[model samples]
Target: MEFVMPVFAGIVVIFGLVKRVPVFDIFLKGAKEGMLLLYNIAPTIMGLVFAVDLLRSSGAINVICNFVEPAADFLGFPKEIVPMVLLRPVSGSGSTALLTSLYQDCGPDSFAGQVASVLAGSSETTFYAVAMYFGSIKVKKIRHTLVAALIADFTAAVMSIITVRFFT
Candidate 1:
């Protein structure tokens, strides 16, 4: 079914291209607009990255992970997933950085590393989504959404770790 779907999509795309539907020009225009949007948002992304790095270098992240380690273990989670939990709220890039470091420190096949990978994969970029959404619409009701999204991501993380550990 999936193979047939792709073949159908390819046929449609080829048909569109052959019919002189301005696909290339439309694509280039879309790409240009995307690049412009990216350029405008680059500073915000850089600032987010800097803040995350500052958190890491100033020992805040470590302190957080240290305090959460016992509770994490109590919940049957690996201790190394603590940073992933903390960074998930503030910055996705930060969580990814921590995830990478955990992978390197623990090695990918270890239980801790696999669990970290699952946690990282399961989480979302909460702050980035809120910022982009509010920024685009110029609306500012970001009160409960953060809490809700974090809860969802936490659920995803727990399920992902359990599933990956057991089913894989």
Candidate 2:
């Protein structure tokens, strides 16, 4: 009975004679348009992805990570947080991959692994999201957006680790 409402509505739409064309045609056309949109946006997405790749491969990430290590340590962060910090800015997937490695190294049920998982889940990929969305819409003014998003990500990362550590 719960699902019957949708089936009944679909039947009426397909069998009704006023429109004459099958309703499936409408869905097909919408799907085709969505595919076209993806194609148009692929270039911008690729550019963001490649820029992240270069950051990961260039050794610059390690240099930046070192500069922040002292402060991160003062905050009680594990040494591994450096790469997580760097990767979070450039690529979401790459960061997740590093997070996975951390989980494997520390064991999934260990404190560090659990904290990393929480941080990974809670934080946003601030730069990548802004770049992809702005480039897709051709918006040029991104002055404060990235800064705000990064602040939110930082808050989430810190709180995630704290909450996970305290609760479990």
Candidate 3:
């Protein structure tokens, strides 16, 4: 695996040389463009991160969790995963941390662990993705993208619970 990258890179360099392409100049141009794109998207990344943090530190998640506890319980989901359900779409790292905490608190073989695992695999950071993608393209008219992404995220959670129940 370690040798594969170097070998592939060497082959690419050889191929570029044979094609008379200015490999070094092309590489530098690509690097500069990548840096520029990163700069362009930095604000979007910061904004999303700040929003997710605010949702966490402001106790909004807790309030929302309390509100949803009854529905979650009736749906056969646990009381502990309310925060994850809310956060996964907004922030992947936050949800991953929550899932890790669930694993530690309930052990990996436990019901919560299995459900958390499924949720982690099934869902995505919808807001983060949308922010980055749309922000990169400067798309002001999001239309129904947010609604669709959130719906998919909700479906993932429901499916995770149902699937876990069936197998576990």
All candidates: TM-score = 0.75, 0.81, 0.87
Q: Rank order by TM-score, top first?
A: 3, 2, 1
Superposed by TM-score, candidate 1 places the C-alpha of residue 56 at a distance from the truth, in angstroms, of 1.4
Candidate 3, residue 37: CA error in Å?
Answer: 0.8
lDDT of each: 0.79, 0.81, 0.90
The segments of candidate 2 whose C-alpha lies over 4 angstroms from its true place after superposition are: 1-22
What TM-score does prediction 2 earn?
0.81
Ranking by lDDT: 3, 2, 1
Per model, how many backbone clashes are there?
0, 0, 0
* Model 1 accuracy (lDDT, Cα): 0.79
- lDDT per residue for candidate 3 within 1-168, as digits (tens), equals 889999998999999999999999998998999999999899999999998899999999899999999999998888778889988989888898998898889988888888888988888889889999999989989999999999998899889888988988
State the lDDT at 143 in candidate 2.
82
Worst 10 residues of 1 by lDDT: 131-140
**Which residue pairs in model 3 clash with each other?**
none
Q: lDDT: which candidate is best?
A: 3
